[model samples]
Target: MSLRGKRLFSVNCTLGLACLTLCCSVSPLFGQESSTSSSGRWLAPDALVTIAPAMEPGETFQGPVDLPLVLNNPDIAWDPHYAPKSDTLAEMGRDVVFRGEVYCLEFSFKPVRMIAVDIPSFTGVQRKNVWYLLYRVRYLGGDLRPQVEPDAFGNQVFATPQSVAAETISTPKRFFPVFRLQVKGIDREYPDEILPAAKRAIAARERVGQPLYDTVEIMKQSLPVTTAAGGHSLWGVATWVDVDPRTDFFAVLVQGLTNAQQLKMQGEQIEYLQKTLVLHFSRPGDTMDEMQDRIRYGIPALEDPQRQQYILDQFGVEKRLDHLWTYR
Candidate 1:
């Protein structure tokens, strides 16, 4: 008999025995069935084992009848999705598990890449790429509710279940065949050849310009008045200020260029001054306070009298000097 037939018989036998036990109060014969339930005690003719025809000492028996002792079918079939058709003849080397009710499966594969050489340039380029595919298949008719619950770490986790409500389902019902194919090398063309050409096209039409548009002569004429006493021109005072610099005032002057021309030129000068100050203070590993003190005494070349006066007014000379020592 077939494996399915045997299963059906076993199921029927179990049901019959259950019914007999239930009807035992009405029939006395039902009690006898319970007493003979142990193995080696025959409840039915097929359920009991019969010893084979005695083999002569050391004489072997091998035939169709002998095969029945070894032959046993587990009654399992390969999943249809990954299995090859009768015409295709491709064998699935990997093991796969399938649950007909839930219709979900997962597996792994290694990615492969193919490279090709361009005939004109003789340069190798990536041609094709393949990624490992793994999936879970689901039947459309079953419930597809999301199984989400908070985990111990206070994060939500999803569990795979056989069925869920229609409203809670998100994934589309589709057949997923999980597979790992050792795909042989195949050359497929890349799609980014036009990217470099596009970039070149944009670069050829770009424009560039400077910040302040005024002429250099206009900048010289707008120089601020010198605050030095006794016939000292602003240029002379600037020279003297640099010689014995007051660092704090220089920072204030640089900060006051909110509406000044020659902005780029002033920026370059400030950068140079900062670089020089850093080198001087860093030579012997001077402490932050000492470097700040040196900066506090350096004066700036200001080109606006009103801006200069504003700085002195907002922060008194002493306070401004203190700031130079502490300013970042």
Candidate 2:
């Protein structure tokens, strides 16, 4: 077998061993499903939501950021261009001089789950409901680089307009995830928090022996590409506490899965936005006696055609869209 094949086989074996250890050794908590529940330890294949790496040509950025000379000379770091030479003209406009490559990671995740936890507060410790989203990502080792192709005749220096080409690379990738839960209509946003007590309770309740990382801890880990036989996956959970019980429809905005971003020129100022993943969900029935299991994935379909609009309005989406990617 070739070197690539041998490496893939080794990775597959390691993954299998890890799974076996979790399944055979981990003990389930009382009332915990420990298998296929939404809050279960192992991620179900049917519940996986996969988002492929994507970026547009316009999203490539090349301006004042990330310069070699700016690092050496701190005084000129604020300049649009590096320290200007006495003989050369200083760049006046904010236009991008040279575009750079855009690298994105392939992200996959399981459905969001809800759990109740005893957390601290200003008054004292109290039991509060928490919502968490589990996810994993992999690095495919390719980046989209801006380039111009030559013509068939080879006479023209540049035949086509500047475009992007895929180039293979091998390097470690990190995920600095920022998850926000937004409730439609009310326009309330809850950012994910790092709760040590909640994390321990969740690990036990989920019966997952493998260390599940929070936002900060997961950022330090590296991800590698996965093959058919095995997957080098990094598992993480985003937790939100004290969400309003009346929130029937909401979306989770996940960022940092990819390095793709957009730069919009607005007069002399520029607005920067990063690629984000939006996961849509809605719960049926009234908010009274709210339960964690009642939360369902995707937009809820109502039996009554007349009431469908009301449900759709709650989601703030025109149609039934489970998830989508956009720059925000």
Among all candidates shown, the one with the greatest lDDT:
2
lDDT of 1 by residue, 1-328 (tens): 9999999999999999999878653521421222122232334433221211111111111111211112232232233576454322122211211212221111111111111222222474332211111111112223323355789998986545335433444443322111111111121211112222222222232111111111121124222111111110100000010111112222211111111111112321211111000000101113233222322222232468776555554343432232221111
Question: TM-score: which candidate is best?
Answer: 2
Q: By summed lDDT, which 10 consecutive residues of candidate 2 come out lowest?
A: 87-96
For model 1, what is the error of residue 78's alpha carbon versus the real structure, in angstroms, after optimal superposition?
Answer: 46
Model 2 agreement with the true structure over 1-328: per-residue lDDT tens digits: 9999999999999999999878867754421222244444454556567777766655455454433333344555243356564322222322335566676777666666777788987999998777887776766545665655666776544222343322334456788999999988788999999988788777776644356889999999876554333345666788988788778788999899777776655544466788898888876656566653466778877788768888777776688788888888
Error of 2 at 269 (Å): 1.1
CA lDDT for candidate 2: 0.69
lDDT of 1 at 142: 31
TM-score of each: 0.11, 0.71
